[model samples]
Target chain A: MPLLEIRNVTRRFGDFVAVDNISLSIESGEFFTLLGPSGCGKTTILRMIAGFDLPDAGQILLDGQDLAGTPPEKRPVRTVFQSYALFPHMTVAQNVAFPLKMARCSADETRQRLGEALEQVHLTDKAPAYPHELSGGQKQRVALARGLVNRPSILLLDEPLGALDAKLREEMQIELINLQRDVGVTFIFVTHAQVEALALSHRIAVMREGRVEQVDEPARLYAFPKSRFVADFIGHINLLDAQVLEATHGHLRLTIAGLGEMIAPPLAGAAPGGKGTFAIRPEQVRIGIHGEVTELKNHFPGEVTHFLYRGDVTVYKVRLANGMMIEALLPNSAPGGAELFKVGDPVRVGWRHDAGVFLHE
Target chain B: MSDEHANLSPAARLTKWLVSGPPFVFLLLFFVAPSIIMVVASFRYPGEFGGLAPVAAADPATLQGLTLETYRFFFSDFIYTEIFIKSFFVALATTVICLVMAYPLALLIARSPKKSRDLMVLLVILPFASNFLIRVYAWMILLGPQAALSQLVNGVLGAVGAGPVHLLFSPFAVLIAMVYVHLPFMVLPLYTNLEKHDPSLLDAAQDLGANAWRRFWHVTFPLSLPGIFSGSTLVFIPVLGMFAIPDILGGTGDMLIGNLIKEQFLGTRDWPFGSTLSIMLTLAVLLCVWLAARVGSTRGRYA
Candidate 1:
């Protein structure tokens, strides 16, 4: 059994349902992330788990015990808010010492725990400093220290790195991952940043419109998203409308309007001759001057309409004869590649058999 | 905006002053001048006929020969000193009571459900809309002997056969009146401060393992100190000089410094003593405000 189990939890604010009936289980010591856009109920779910919010319907179980009517203070779960809500009045030491003090720990124990907590965050030197004196990254570290000091069974983080700069956020993400490993505690993180979620989580639950669209390990979620929403949300995916022409022995033959017949790997539970959408990652499509199809299955003939010379790769907007536009990211290694993929240049776009996956439109 | 006024001259300054001079002069004449006159008169003795008679009519412009006799009189009398001490204590009590009551109410208002929060705030502020003197009078009716409250207590003390308990015309009445009158004054600032508090910070605290009480003591309370100071100062300063509520509910026997000042001025017909008492009251209020400001700054800075 998972350490924390949310069984059909539903939360509503008056007439508006913030979180629809949903359930998920978080395993022990796993860095689980709830990734979604704002108002997608990711934070609401985290709140429910932390006992800050009670579900209107269903139950939240911690360690196989029902957490019904348990106040946040009584719960074993702790949450780190987006703002890094450090006690502005208290010094870092006092702030870290608070939970232990609340738990009725002795003076020696409080001091020892506070020292360890501060040392974990590498903020022992600034223990006397107030929240205002600390930088954004430092404040977040302090918040981490305060949360971990209590040694809660599960630490809930609500966009812990959202307030940091890009560089700082990247740094903290690694630091947080390391911290989670060191503490060996179950961490349920909430964020709208897909990269952050994917990079940190042992498992990612991609949420949309008050429901969990897909929940899986980051690689699987990105590689084989079950829905168009999950696929589009995770990364940049070029969606193409297609009709499955044949289905035989775990292989699907789909005819796309702009790009003709592509024999792709079988999609689980999808019927042959059914209308579906296919998703291909931008980077997966190879753009070249040669129109001849290679060993790859899906090939499309198009004219490059616009070119974007990004530092790492040159992206081309290819316009097919059927008026459908497809994007391809090509490495900028060729000397004249910037000018080579000029406006109105005839180009061939091709991908492997497994590149395109059937998804709900 | 400054570029447009670059061509403006010193003459414009004079013109601006001239345009604003009437109200300034009018305020000086009515407000500032009388205050100075009161200070001057506080040093003078009562004349044979009554009212303020200049101690040194020969040098009408100055008060070089003024004595501390009025101040000495108030200090010498036990009644005046007792009343003065009682007023300070009561004001302090009122301030503490207000802080205790307002903090939770302010927090509730700040954190209440959005749909009902506004209406709840309006309800809290509704009592403030009522007439101040009328509310005190209403308290008098409720707390007076043979009043509803007195009868209720008497009913509770049935075994003793106490028909109607003596409830009003006491310090308790004075304290209740002061707290009731100034509770909103305390709550408004606290609410404003608490409302401005970014809630994400509280979540940050919880995530840190700080429990509910710890979060409040460390985070919430410290953040709201400025509001607490302002609210307490607002309540305490005025409460020291509050005469109307005490007069109506506290009865004539239990008088405060304000009542003492009023008695000196009108009843006893001693303008100098009244002026001295008023000056003392003003000094006390200024002292309270300064102390509050100093304490607030220290606490807020550390908090």
Candidate 2:
């Protein structure tokens, strides 16, 4: 059995359903993420698991025991809040030791566990300082220590790094991964940033409109998105409205509107007369001034409508002969840091036949 | 401060004075002058009939001495000292009772949804729109012998084998009136402070294994100490010098320092003795304020 199971949970506020009938089963020690935009019910699901909220319909089970009517205090789950809600009145050590004290642990045991918790977050030196005196990063560490002090089986992080600066967020992301590995606790992470979800989670559940669109490993979720929403939401991708001409032998021949025809990978549940979107990542297409090559099964002659120089790579938005715009990215790997292409330059963009995937909308 | 202001242009200085001068002159005239007169008057001897004697009387029979006679007279009697102690206890009791009654109400108003919190706060302040004395009078009718509350209370006492007791014109009535009159002073400050508290802190506490009561005791209460201190001071200071509540609702035995002070000024017309008593009350209030501030600061480090 899964360590935690949310069985057909539904939550409603007034007439609006914040979380529709959804269910998920998480295994022990897995770094699972619920990734979505705001109001996608990601936080609602997390709150339900932490026992801060209840599902109107369905059940939540922890270790195969139904957690109905259990208050947050009795649940073996802790949440690191978005604001890092450390007690302003307590010292770092006291904040970290509160759970142990609540459990009625002996003085020696609390002290030992408190010391270990603080040291785990590298906050041992800040034990005596009050929360207001600590920097934001230190306060976040104290919050983390306090949550982990009692050694809960599962930890829920509600956008814990959302408040940090970009550089510090990167550093803390690494620390969080290492800490999760060391503690071996099931981490249920929630984030709106796709990069954060991809970088941190062992498995990603891409959510949209109170529903999980896909749940898979990061590489698979990125390479083969199941729907246009998943492909558009996860990262930068160009989507084209296509007409499926034929389907046979695990290959679908689709004609993209104004970009000509190409053989796309098998589109599940697609008929020859059906309509769907052809999705390809920006990095998959090769952009240059060279004409069509035989190695490339799909090639288009286009003019560079615009170029975005993002230091390591430049994305060129090219308008094809039929006025369909396609985004292609090329790394700045050539010598001397000069931009190779500018607006109005004629460019040839091509990709292998298998590079693009067909989504059944 | 003068040196810093010297660098300003004439118009700047004029603007500065225009902003600060009114309150400065007002305090000087109304507060500083009266305090100086009272301090000087407290040292003078009383006239034979009532008012103070001449400042420099030549006749030996006339009372014109600048002496500590009132202070000496005050220390020479224990009754006056007893009134101060009784008044202190009443004020302390009122503060504790107000704190207890106001906390839950304040927390409720603070935790209420934002759209309705204004309506709730309006209800708390709505009672204050009426005359204060009229409110005290309203309490009188509620505690009157013929009132249902008194009858119910006396009935409960009678059933318990205790003799029926009067509710009005007693210390209990006086205390009840005092608390009712001063409750808004406690609730407003507490609500303001509690409203500023982040609701997430309580959730964090609960998530860390603290039950409802522990969350309140450990997180909510400690954070509200500032509100408690302000409310306590607001209720304690005014109740210390309050005369009308006791005079209206209390029995003759409920004479506090406020009654004693009032009697000196109005009944005996002993302005010098009244000044001395007023000075003593001032000193006592200052002491209490100093002690409260010290406690607030010492515990306010975390808050």
Q: How close is every model to the real structure, measured as TM-score?
A: 0.85, 0.94
Across A227-293, the per-residue lDDT of candidate 1 in tens digits comes to 9889889988888898888877768888887557887778766676688888888888887766444
Docking class of 2: medium
Off by over 4 Å in 2: A248-250, A267-271, A291-294, A335-338, B1-16, B58-63, B146-164
lDDT at position A95, candidate 2: 90
- The worst-scoring run of ten residues by lDDT in candidate 1 chain A lies at A289-298
lDDT of candidate 2 over A1-361, digit per residue (tens): 9999989989999987888888899999999999999999999999999999999999999999999889999999999999998888888888999999899999999989998888889988999899989987888888888888899989999999999999889898998999999999999999999999999999999888888889999999999999899999998999888989999877888887767888887766788879888899998887776644335878878899888888888888989888878898777885433277789988788888778788885
Clashing residue pairs in candidate 2, if any? Answer: none
Clashes of 1: 5
Instruction: Evaluate candidate 1 and give its CAPRI docking class based on DockQ.
Output: acceptable
**Quality of candidate 1 docking, DockQ:** 0.42
lDDT per residue as tens, model 2, B1-303: 888888899999899999999999999999999999999999997777887888876786764679899999989998888899999999999999999999999999999999999999999999989999999999889999999998999899999999989899999999998899899999999999999999999999999999999999999999999999999999999999999999999998999889888998889889888899889999999999999899888878886
The RMSD (Cα, Å) of candidate 1 is 4.4
Residue lDDT tens for model 1, B1-303: 787577778899688899999999999999999899989888888755568776666765754457788878878888777878889999999999999999999999899877887888788789878888888888988887767788778788876875655778888898998999899899988898899887876765564456677778767887888888889888998899988877888866779888888877778889999898898888888887888788788777764
